[model samples]
Target: MKLRQKAYALAALLYLEFSNRTRRSSLAEKVWEDSSAEQAMTNLRQTLLHTRDVESRHGFRLFEADATEIELNRDLTIDLREIGRIRAATDAADLATLIDLYRGELLAGVDGLGSEFGQWLSLERTRIENQFAIQATEAALRFGGRTGHAALHKLAERLPYSDTVCRATIELLRAEGNEAGARAAYAAFRNRLRHGLGLEPAAETAELIEQEGAAPVGAQPRTPARRSTDIQPDDTIRPSFVPRVVLLPPLQDFKQASIPRHLAPALVEDVTIGLSRLKSVSVIAPHTAWQLDPFSALDEVRSHQIDYAVESRIAPNFTGDGLSLAIRLVRAAGREIVWADKFAFSALSAQERYWDFTNGVARALADSIETAELQRERTQRDANAYSHYLAGRHNLRTFDLPKIRRGRKSLRIAREIEPEQASIESALARSYVVEWVLRAGSDRALLDKAKLHAERAVSIDPNDGTAYRELGRVALFDRDLDLSLAHMSMAADLAPNHADVLADFADTLVHNSDFNSAQEKIDAAIRLNPVPPDEYLWTLGGINFFRGRWEEALRHLSQMRNPEPAFRLMAAAAAMAGQMDLARRYRLQALKLQPDFTTSRWVSRMPQRDPADVDLYIEALRKAGFK
Candidate 1:
């Protein structure tokens, strides 16, 4: 990259990694600060010349490009991309590869890299390292005996001071029928600790090694810890999660009795559908509220748990030009009028009225759900694919795989039309996540494609939640819990009430061994939409298992009719609860569904909250007749 080209590329990547949907002018400003727009364009042009495969008008395609925008190249073999892929792999070799691939901080030597970009890269690096340490420790514990010992030893050598790895070494020795050796290992670790850092082992670690001299035949399993009291249930009933609403039919006063009777209901339906689109608000059917006929509108709002009540009136213009409409938004809890507005528009034909009503209602609801100060601009992308992508996204929420596939296809077409459309690329990437979860092998390539697309999306529109959400899914699959958490949290902050955003956040929390917080989030998800799919319920069961509430887990797991791989895994948890018969039955059923199901495979699937929990699960699975 030439100096100017390098500056532009660096600026583009910085914006891509940090900003949300940056405009060309904004990017130009950053690249050519204090310079005129013409100069900025000149510099941008120079930057484009660095990319050998890109055309001049393509606007520096990081991934791909089209007429309006340039995005991060999805097929580009960037270091961050490789890091994400390697981090997600479950196999030891993949983990090793990930450690190797995460060579240094992203864009390490780029002089003009913004502080925000530097911070993001720093945090990402920390998360990757933490995950690497945790996984290495778990591997050491799992492969401490027989031919696996060398792997464990290697892992210990790589992460010398990791308490988890050190403890794993001690446990491994004990498992191999080397009681004296186990004691010696623990003593060595203690001596190393005292000599190197002059600190004692953690309470749990000290207890584990205390009985080292006369080590038992087998390692005793540690009991699950109780949840701390600081963790409380998130039952805050905000206006956002309320499902019911009441709308007074628009009352019209006209001198001539020529008004259509059906007009009011049509307007009511329009408003209802518009409000319902907002995940936060659920509008009560007009018919139900009309039938109730309370003493006053406020009474109706109080009785129905309605968060907002809308009342409207229409009047014919005496000049025979237009109709005037008045609308009011009232707070149900306080019976206080929050916002009242009036709109006047030219009298329309019946067909125009129908379209106007829908558009008007949609705009109003959109305004209502939106926070007071917008954090990010919700400007429509200059790509037709965005519309198709949105429609596909709506369908994906229903969990209809056929519909999701169709949506993915629509996104792909959109991608073809506007290849650099970050929004579409993000949507396309998320579709891959769904496909991957559903076991669609043909769509597996989409996962890699999705990561690249998501990276590009973020590059193009760093502030867009969709891109972050897609990237988070990729990170989750890669088992990079830290990156997953960061991305998911960003998505949630950007779109707080979005169901999928909350669900992904909850899932990451579960994987990170924060089950208490995960339960709270799952509860929030259920409250956001009472009837979440079976997968969400299955995750709830996993949360219960981690929290040591086996019966609760079994209860939730039972709700899943067609058992997924995750549901079958719950059988091992059932065994931990001493429900051996039930565990055995579920295990057999799971094995029937997945003949390859084994203790090792099932244990590996589990999110390692506590190493003892892993052992408990393995022991339970073995007892339940799984190999």
Candidate 2:
């Protein structure tokens, strides 16, 4: 679809094509078929040159040609080639790759030159679709028991017209006793077929509807092991455990010898950049790490959910140009020093020297962190409830309903296993608070559920900021602005370096009509969270909206991963700015998510200290067609 020119599209189809390598003459015939032989040759030559130029500008070599033949670059990897390889391979390990590679119809709606190219595309598309059908069927049977039931259902939706895939997915879900899921899958497929292709699924698929499984649905923490044992695969969802590291600001006068103040920040920045480049470790952004002094650094690191701290201090030697630097790699959880060393280097005035020193330090630190994490993992114990709690926390960050429900279930299991885990309790309570805010028709019952767990969590551990944060969010939605601010303020005081809490507090401030304070908190949250979660965008968008920056608000909302509620918000902002057509468009988009959504139920109780802002919000909602 991105192909700009007719020639370029044809060239791509031929060069990267499966099972057909175009001869130079055939390519010329297809692209310039109407021209004379001489003219065609000239056209082909110019097209290839221009195609090569386009590829170069994009920084990738996609095609190569000899005097008589053209082919895709041998070194370059393409999904079609990989799919072919996976189809031939018998190894089950490759099935995952196969399923992922079969990402919709090959080139979807892309068209090619003249009749020859079109014919080739049609044949290839059919071939690829059949192959994917086989792969998804095989994978569904293979991995259905290993994970959730959504995988197969999603695969069925990818090629909705295929009776083969639809039958396989429906059967899998039915076999798992998920009749609702099977019926939902069938209906989704039926809808796709009717709307997208103006056809229905096979009559056999109609039979599946009576049996069930048709609905489509959408939507971490802690701990230490008690003993040395092999780590078992836990029945929880979490990212692969990788060591997260943070670099402290280098101390300039630990030895009571002075170095230039600016030099420490610069060298620390260089070291942070180098560490960040290591693929094995997640480095805390230097901006957040800089907030930590040596006294409070470890506590802050642990609160940020980082595993290791690269603590370093530089001191000038009294008599020489050389500076002495001490570095320690610490395990944040246990406060254990995993690795430590000292070195001497000349003051790096030359850029080359500075890079050489910084790169070495980074590699060494990264290597040490990796080794330490591996050592810890090798001695890890059987999976515990804490593992599930951590998994739940990770899922909660996704900010979608399916994931939220999945996470909440994990936390419930965790609490059942370890009733005393304050963190688990807090996390479960927060899930309720989040559901109350985001989900349609949220009621006081959800707040009651949140209150029980949050209070219990706070009772169990009075210092836990997460419990307070959940309480704060609940109060904010209830329009108790003063109560909400009080609780959220305490959350920040207890966990100042926590990006999640800070972002939530920022959102609360916006609802309370305190835009300036909200801006400051949101900025700090962004800096603290190097990889800020999608929820942060929604929070910042709210701030922009209340601050009378409609376009900026829309910009933020547009970047969200799930933009339903955002579209509703965008509609209001657009209408307030007198962009009625845009408002209507956004309103229609939001209605697709919740057809009966009304401003009264959604926004009437919004916490606001300013009467004018409240009136403005009401006017905008009406203007956006919200009843």
**Per-residue lDDT over 1-627 for candidate 1, one digit per residue giving the tens place of the 0 to 100 score:** 245446434544544443424445545545554466788766666565555345345544463334345555454455555644542456566655555554443444554533333333433333445455555556545534552466556655655544565667777777878767777666676666556544333334555776645533322222112224222234443422233446666566543335544444444543453344354444554444555433245444443335556666565553465666656665443333445566663223333343344444344444554422221333444334444444555445435678778878877776776676666777777777877777623344767877988899888777667678888877877767788888888876665555546667787888788887887777666544444556667778778877778887777777765565554657777788888888878887877767876667545554454577677667767877789
Residue 273 in model 1: lDDT: 34
C-alpha TM-score for every candidate: 0.45, 0.43
State the TM-score for model 2. 0.43
**Which stretch of 10 consecutive residues in model 1 shows the poorest summed lDDT?**
218-227
How many steric clashes between backbone atoms does each model show? 12, 20
Give lDDT tens digits, candidate 2, residues 126-242.
446666666657656766664324445555556555656777777777788878767777677666655654444443445455444332321022222222322111222124444
Error of 2 at 231 (Å): 41
Q: How many steric clashes does model 2 contain? A: 20
